[model samples]
Target: MEKMKPTLTVIMPAYNELKNLRGAFISATGALKIAGISDYEIIIITNTKRDGSHDGTPYVAEQIVKEDSRVRHIHNNSYVGLGFKFRQGIGDARKSFITWVPGDNENIEESVAGIFRHIGEADMITSYTSNTQVRKWKRRFVSRCFTEFCNLLFGLRLKYYNGICIYPTKLLQKVPTKSDNFAYMAEIIIYLVKSGVRYKEVPMEIKPTAISSSFKLKSVFEALGTIALLFWNIHFKRTRIKIGSIN
Candidate 1:
């Protein structure tokens, strides 16, 4: 296969981010432009199923793309969950590097540039903020627990594996993405640990937002459950491979 242009393909998955979608793309694309990285593409995957129209995201994306060819928008007719959408976008990406920027716009331009630069040297680059300006206390606590659990289980202490992450496309190919929701983020981290890929962390400032739906107790539990499911998948699949060898 011909090598993809040395570009960064950013996948931003949205459920119903009609209000914040445009600004997110503008900021992201502008950041790359400021950094002089014109050879990049922003693939926005909008999952608007229950909304009055499925074309909301597509419309916004089209307007952005019209303004700049570097910006492209694709709509997911059927909501296949977060992990599935991320896989589809990254899978379709023709680039050397991949990043998943949240639709909420937490990852700003400077931070995006910083993270991408970090990924230039490392297989994976993660970021975190000691004071997440927009998140709730419960969400923060759960995030800390998840990070600690990952450290204990994988021996890698990454600051914020759950937020904006940039990695080489090769590493993503090596790791499987199975979560339907935000668990996809954690699953990626776990897979990286198992595959023994090189990784690094960077500090970032959390931009303020009044968005209340970003966090919920149920979502936290769902995230934890996703981690458990990943462990089960890994253990059972590994054992089956061993058994097949024996047979």
Candidate 2:
């Protein structure tokens, strides 16, 4: 007569993160155990450049896979975008719920456990950072602008779009997200929200780290372009066909 706990697949994308991958994996495992999630798998997607540069991460990931049967490694010979890695994880996931934890170790065990504790309360568990002061002023400003712009463009008032969000595997697989950049997270959230999927926003605390690679000028431009394309496709190019309800 008790409700069953949902199984989870934790997608961890590592690109030249040999220093942080092991710690991230430890944190993920600890968090899952803290949340009392007995059924889970961690997929570590490691990437190396075509020229054989950045080779260390794949080796570490493979070692982790060998050490833990619950961990799987998906190696990319060439450097693909993060969005592509995310999609690959989604395709490989075999669980009731799916969420991503970056290999940079920015999300610690307690924060992840906080997010996991709220599972099954809604169709999706969307997280926002409670402490933005942990980041530099420029990064904080940019994040605020991005979130506001997304809200204005999509007419949704969500707290954050790029944080670790938990989605049902089946529901996420149906969304045709087209961004090969960081904007893909926003794209997925927008599509699901527009389709009337219920979501709950939770607050998470992030650890301070060096400037992220995604903060580069090129990535900013790429995200802008992707958002423009998403806007066009969502508003003008196609009709908003409703996916089946999660409820």
Q: Give the clash total for candidate 1.
A: 1
Tens digits of per-residue lDDT, candidate 2, 1-247, equal: 9989989999999988989999999999999999999899999998777575894998899899999999999998887888999999999999989999999998878888999999899989999999888888878887888899999998999999999999989889988886878888998998888778889999999898877877788988998998888888878876353667542
Tens digits of per-residue lDDT, candidate 1, 1-247, equal 9533347888987766678778788778777766556677888887667444564666777777789776667776665577878898877887778888777666678866766666565667777775674666666776678789866755566776677778777667656676776678878876765655566777766677654443566666777787787777766564111111110
TM-score of 1: 0.83
| Reference-based TM-score of each model | 0.83, 0.96
Q: List all candidate RMSDs to the true structure.
A: 5.3, 1.4
- After TM-score superposition, the amount by which residue 46's alpha carbon in candidate 2 deviates from its true location, in angstroms, is 1.3
| Candidate 1 runs further than 4 Å off | 1-6, 50-55, 211-214, 234-247
How big is the positional error of residue 179 in model 1, measured in Å on the Cα after superposition?
0.9
Which candidate has the top score in TM-score? 2
